[model samples]
Target: MYINGAWEPAESGATFAVTNPATGEKLADVPDGGRAETVRAIDAAHAAFRGWAGLTAYQRSEFLYRAWTLMLERKEHLAQTMTREQGKPIRAARNEVQYGADFLLWYAEEAKRVYGETIPAPRGDQRFIVLRQPVGVVGAVTPWNYPVSMLTRKIAPALAAGCTIVLKPAEATPMCAIEMFKVLHDAGIPKGVVNLVTANDPAPIGEEFLSNRKIRKLTFTGSTEVGKMFARGAADQMKRVSLELGGHAPFLVFDDADPVHAAKGAAMVKMLNTGQACISPNRMFVQRSVVEPFLDELVSRVTRMRAGNGMEDGVAVGPLVDDGAIEKVDRQVKDAVAKGAKLLCGGHRLMDNGLDRGTFYAPTVLADVRPDMLIYREETFGPVAPVIAFDKEEEALEMANDTHYGLASYVYTQNLARGMRIFEGLDFGIVGINDINPTAAAAPFGGSKQSGLGREGGHEGIGEYLETKLGGFSV
Candidate 1:
């Protein structure tokens, strides 16, 4: 663990093994921290908050820029580490590293852009101004999927906004966080400005985050249940909270769209991270006139994907994070099939072709999927595509919006007017009109409804770590 700019073991000398999801090989033994360790880290962050936040935006930007450059220089190493621990294809891991590093650069420039405003005063000789100041110490928790990007998405903004932070990375992927902090430390971040705590069990650390008065904000990226728990805990303190949680995004393919193009986009995005993404489209709504063509194209692309260890060459799909992920996905597929969905292709676990050791599942495609099925309502964080047929635009729109989650929704239509209408109608934080990859470092990424609270990335990201102080003066 990295705490107070020092590498240390748990006070109890307890450690937990980090294994590769692809091979089940022990990667490393990380310190097992609990509530006590969390308090220590939080104290350090509180002590350093004033000094860190005292730095000018330009000075903070220099530290961020240096870290960004160092991250790029070690991009290959970071990618390999992520692939080993997180079970993503090496190619995808590399792309994620690139994507994650971009956040540092983006926020480095944004550090100077935390703008304030001057308000007109009603009375003579009275003036009012609003200043954006850093919120105090922050506590953050990140999930395993997209481990590197998720950490950078939170860390870059907090540091850029001049807030000290204590992070608890997901237990399944602590090595990635350790390596990332190495880069930040090498870039000359001050002591106690950033801290990382790894724990086998996360409950105690989370409790400390809520109970500790020094922690002014809590940022989390994980399951909806856990995010809600954090939200409830933070209510007592009224600590600033930002959550990026679960998503069951819907992909709408209208009849006017070319079936082949839409299918390719859907397959590509659905299979990303083996479909372990908050924004991964969980339901595919196709106009009835083009359902057959879309299914045919989607099936072909999905079946052609190769599943194996992430480090191996030519492997497209990698193992799921663990047995639990495999079971959840398998259960969803079986329920969908039992409920009358046609299994077009790749419906079972992939144990053949030298894949028996890892938790690998086939890239599945299902057609004639109904809302009664489990996959329709739940997120199958695996490479399973369920296609639902729709007749009219209104029906498709209604089905798409009929979900508690509102993270990301994709629409494909050649008609400009129809695309615009659907884009406006979709009740999601991000609406991709004829685009599958909607998230960017320059744009806001988050959700509404039960999906999550607050945004990550873009100009709004840094705002989460800042407070607005209105100054009123009479001269």
Candidate 2:
């Protein structure tokens, strides 16, 4: 663990094993830190907050820029580290590394652009001004999936906004966080300004983050269930909280669009990170007239995808995170098939051909899926795409917006008017009109309803770590 700008083990000497999901190999034994460790880290961050936040934005920007350059220089090494722990394809890992590094570069520039405002007062002698200041010590928890990007997304903005932070990365992928901190430390971030804690269990660490008074803000990227718990816990302290939670995104395919092209796009997005991402389209809604053709094309592509160890060449899909994820996905597929949904292709676990050592599931596609099935309601979180046929535009739109999750929704329509209408109608934080990849360092990435609170990217990201102070000055 990296805490107080130094590498240290848990005082209790307890450690937990980190294994490669692809090979089930023991990678390393990380410190199994708990509440005591968390408190120490929190205190360290609190002690360093004032000094870190007092630095000029330009001075802070230089540190971030240096970190950004180091990240690019070590991009390949970081990508390999991510794939080894997280079970994502090497190419995808590289892309994520590049994407994650961009946050540092972006926030570096944004540090200088944290603009304040002056408003006209009713009285001539009085002036009203609003200043954006750092929110003080922050506590963050990131998930296992997209390990590289999630940390950079949270840490970059906090530091750029002049806030000190204590982060507890997902136990499954702490190596990525460790490597990232090395870059930050080498870039000359001061002691106690940033801290890291790794643990086998999250409950104890989370308790400290929630209950600690010194932590003025909390940011988390994980499930809605845990996010809700954090929200309720933080209510007592009224600590500033930002959550990027679960998503069950829907992809709409209208009859006017080319079924083949739409199928290609859907396959790519659905299979990204083996469909582990929050923005992966959960339900694919196709206009009835083009439903058959789309399914045919989609099934063909899914079958053609090669699944193996992420480090190997020509491997597009890799192992699932663990056995639990495999079971959940398999259960969903079974329930959907039992509920009368037609399984087109690839519906079982890939345990043959030396794949039995790791948790691997075949990319699956189901058609004629009804809302009564489990796959229709819950997030599949795997490479299983359920196709629901719709006749009218209103029906498709209604089905798209039916979910409580409102993170990302996709619409494919050649008609400009119809695309615009669907874009407006879908109640999601991000709408991709004829686009599968809608996220970037410069764009706001978050959800609307149960998906999450506050944005993660763009200028709004830095705002999460800042508090607004309004002053009435009289001269």
Candidate 3:
């Protein structure tokens, strides 16, 4: 753990092992941080907030820019470490490192653009000014799926907006967080400005974040159920919160869409983190006329997907984070098949090819998945694709919007009018017309309804870490 600009262990001398999900091997032991450690980190951030917030935006930008450069320079090491810890393919991990670095770079520039505004008052010789100021100390809880990207997404904007932060990364992937924080420290981040605490049991740490008066903002990226708990805990203080929660994203493939192209795109996105991503296409709705062709292309593409250790050559998919994830995926697939859905390809867990000890699941595709099936209602956070057919545009739209989650949705269509209509009608915060990955450092990333609250990137990202002040003056 890094707290108060120094690396330290837990006060209780306890530690937890971070395991390699692909092989179930122990990677490294991290500090088992709890309430005491969390309190120390929070205090450090709170104490450092004045000095950090006092620095000019340009000054902050310099540190961020340096960190960005360092991240790129150490890209290879970061990628390897991420692959070891998070189990994504080396290529995917490398891309994640680059994507994470972009946040630092983007925020470095954006820091200089956090401009204040002046307004004229009705009274003679009166002036009004609106200023955006840092919201003080922040508490960030990030998930494990995209550890590097999620950490950067929260901290970059917070730092750019002049707030000090105490971060608690997911227990399953703490090495990446520790490594990134080292880069930040080396890049001249002020002592105590940024702190990190690793803990397997997050409840104690989370409680401190909620009760600590000094922490003005709490940001989290995880399940909606956990997000609600944080919201309730923060209610007393009315603490500012930003949540990027769960999603059961819908992928709509219209008859006009090239079935092969659409299938290829959906497969690519769905296979990212083995479809564990919150925005991964969960329910795929295809126009009935094009269902068979789409399934053919999708199954063929998925069938070729190679799942094994991330370090292996030519591996496209990797193991689930743990045995529990594999079990959940297994249960969903079995239930779907029992409920009359046809298993097109790769339905069972993969144990051969040196994968017996690891948490691996075969890339699965199910056809004729109905509304009542468990896979249809719940998120299949694994390498599974469930295809549902619809006859009319209305039916497709209705099926897409039936879920409580409104995080991300994809529509594949050649017609501009229909695309625009679907775009307007969809309830999700993010809509991908033909694009699988719509998230970017320069755009706001968030969801509507149960998916989440507030945004993570772009100008809006920085806004979450800032407070507005209005001043009136007579001259």
Candidate 4:
């Protein structure tokens, strides 16, 4: 981990193995950072906050631009490392690197545009001005699914807002975070402005972050359960928090939409990161009038998807992150199948053609999934698509909004009026009509309800690390 501008090991000299999920091989050992290391990182960030916050936005942007350039320069190597560690397909890994770089580039330019407001006071001799200031040291926790993009999504905006950060990357995939720190270091970022602590047991570190007063803000991306815990912990200190947590996205295929094209889009969304992404479509609802044709097209598309090691060429789907993920996916499939859902193609693990050694699940398609089934309500964070049929628009809307999660939802329809109606009716924060990919650096990415709190991108992202102060001046 990098701390106080130097590469260092854990104070206790403890290290843990980082494994390649695709091969079940140990890649390297990273520091097993704990409470003590977290404190060190926090203190360092707090000490460096003044200097970093004092720098002009233009100056900060220059450093961010340098880091962005370095990321692009090392794109291929970074992507390869991500594929080896995070288990996404090589092409997807490359796209993640590019996506991560885009955040840095976008924030680099956005830093100079943080605007304040001035208002006339009620009194004749007074003026009111609202100023945005950095929110002190930030404690960031990122997940492993989209390793590079998740880290950049948190750090880029925090840095652009003139806040220092002590980040804890997921233990399963720390190599990308380490590599990103190298880019920041080489970009001439001031010492202690950014710090990293990698730990398998993150509870102790999280405790410190929640209780520490110097760490004014907490930003996290992970499960909703964990996000709730963080929210409760931060409540005592009244710490500002921004959470981008779990999602059970719904993909709706209307009767008017082309079943073949909609099926292809749904398959693409569900297969991303082997369905590990929080925003990946989970519960797919199709109108009964076209459910059969849609299922046929969907099964065909899923069957054509090649599952193998990420390093292999032409492999669209890769292994799940680990054994635990595989088990969870298997359990859900079995439960769904036993409860009357028809398994169209796959519902088992793939152990053939060099995939026996790794954690791989075949892309599965399930039809006639009922509301009572576990797969219908829970997040199947694997390549298993459980679909249900709805006859009316009201029924489809009711089924889509049935979950506790409100992260994202998709509606595929040829009719503009129907699309607009569903788009407005869906309870999710992000709605896609005919578009499967809804993520971008320029858009506000977040959800309502248990999906998350606050946003992570666009102008709202920078605001997550900023505090507003109103000043009344006598003129």
Task: Give the lDDT of residue 286 in candidate 1.
Answer: 95
Return the TM-score for each candidate structure.
Answer: 0.99, 0.99, 0.99, 0.99
Q: Residues 67-161, candidate 1: write the lDDT tens digits.
A: 99999999999999999999999999999999999999999999999999999999999999999999999999999998999999999999999
True-vs-predicted CA distance for residue 70, candidate 1, Å: 0.3
For model 3, residues 271-309, the per-residue Cα lDDT tens digits are 988998999999999999999889999999999999888
**Candidate 2, number of clashes:** 0
TM-score of candidate 1 to 2 decimals: 0.99
Clashing pairs in 1: none
Per-residue CA lDDT of candidate 4, range 1-475, in tens?
Answer: 8889999998889999998877888899999989988898999999999999999999999999999999999999999999999889999999999999999999999999999999978999999999999999999999999999999999899999999999999988999899989999999999999999999898998999998899999999999999999999999999999999889999999899999899989999999899999999999999998998899998999999999889989999988988899999999999988999999988998998878888999999999899888888888899999999989999999989999999999999999999999999999999999999888999999999999999988988899989999999998
Quote the positional error of residue 198 for candidate 1 in Å: 0.4
Which candidate model has the greater lDDT, 2 or 4?
Answer: 2
Weakest 10 consecutive residues, lDDT, candidate 3? 351-360
> How high is the CA lDDT of each candidate model?
0.94, 0.94, 0.93, 0.92
In angstroms, the error of model 4 at 105 is 0.8
